[model samples]
Target: MLLQSPWPSRVNDSSTKATHVFITDFLKEKGVSTLDVLVNNAAIGSECFKETFDVNVVGTVAVTWANVNRVLR
Candidate 1:
């Protein structure tokens, strides 16, 4: 379920959460136990100030720490 968007391929907080969980779940399902790279790729612009924080700051924080707590060794 790929999204076709002119908005470009930007990762957000929700996506970060989803991605981290997706990888973790995939590893669990396959009985694999190792995590090397966890990319927190989310972005925003100056034009949308509020949205920037909502997406970039808050979203990143929530996702990053949640991922760490859930996936870290």
Candidate 2:
């Protein structure tokens, strides 16, 4: 139950940062909650080294970090 996911944007897209911020902010505004298991489902296969790491690894970590300690009690 992550707030934001960077998988929507193409791999290596810088806009993912903004999306993460937006989702976190949205959750805060509405008093949303935090998440436990972050399923890294959305990933793109690549023929190069950079794309594979950026999408599957970097993006997944970035999105998951945004949800940490964001739960409102």
Candidate 3:
């Protein structure tokens, strides 16, 4: 199934735990126990500054933190 899908698949909400769980399962399914690198590049320049900051700053931090602990040494 994954082989049929396109590369560079995206996870919409990085801050969501469900997304993290999905990622954990997906990686496991692919026989990956840990991540090698995590790139937090979720940036946006929306009209609402707070919203932009939440997604770009908080969300990125949240995602990176969640994945860092799981990455391979």
Candidate 4:
């Protein structure tokens, strides 16, 4: 089954440690032991480089790290 959960609307919000924990916890609560794939498509086009980088890079890394263990090889 493909389970899709709502992510934080703001990239900055989604990048936080708390958000990471919430994602994993949500999955666990839903009985998801493993994931076949992960798609980090959260990004934004902004005049502020920091904002863009935070969402595109830091956010991706944070989310990936949070769920890496649950992903299937």
Candidate 5:
């Protein structure tokens, strides 16, 4: 099944623990037991280094870790 869930686009919002929980809950609510692949493509090319790091680096790690158990090995 192809589940297309909405992720937070904003830098601050994307990396939060709440966002990760929400995403996981969303998948569970939709009956997604396991995911074949997770395409974490959230990024930002802003002048602010913190914003860029938050979205590109922190956000990616947070989301991946949050859903790691759901991914098919």
Candidate 6:
């Protein structure tokens, strides 16, 4: 089993970029140079549609772009 420890952060907040950077650094520290897969699974539920869009859509884009280089082609 590929167990990954969760690092939870508010993806809709201003700290999103910083969070991604920190995650990248943390992975580097673990001797991980490239990511074979990335599962953007966090999503703000339907109770708030705009928040859902912000977190699920924009947040996914932000995090993905931030780690683009670290992903395996």
Tens-digit per-residue lDDT, 1-73, candidate 6 = 1125453443443587876776677577778877787545465344566777688889999999999989856
* Residues 1-73 of candidate 4: C-alpha lDDT, one tens digit per residue: 1235353233345478876766667578778776667545455334565677688889999999999988855
Ranking by lDDT: 3, 6, 5, 1, 4, 2
TM-score: the better of candidates 1 and 4? 4
Give each model's whole-structure lDDT: 0.64, 0.59, 0.70, 0.64, 0.64, 0.66
Task: Judge candidate 1 at residue 42 and give its lDDT.
Answer: 44
Error of 1 at 73 (Å): 1.3
Question: What clash pairs does model 3 have?
Answer: none
TM-score of 3: 0.38
By lDDT, the best candidate is 3
RMSD of each: 12.8, 14.1, 12.4, 13.1, 13.1, 12.6
Model 3 residue 61 CA deviation in Å? 25
**Model 6 CA lDDT for position 19:** 65
What TM-score, computed on C-alpha atoms, does each candidate reach?
0.30, 0.29, 0.38, 0.34, 0.33, 0.33
Q: Candidate 6 lDDT (Cα, whole model)?
A: 0.66
lDDT of 4: 0.64
Most TM-score-accurate candidate: 3
lDDT of 6 at 20: 77
Please tell me which model should have the higher lDDT, number 3 or number 6: 3
Candidate 5 segments exceeding 4 Å error: 1-47
Name the TM-score of candidate 5: 0.33
Model 3: per-residue lDDT, tens digit, 19-52? 7876797788889888887654455233565776
Per-residue lDDT of candidate 1, residues 1-73 (tens digit): 2334555344344687876676667568667799776544345444666776588779998999889967776
Worst 10 residues of 2 by lDDT: 3-12
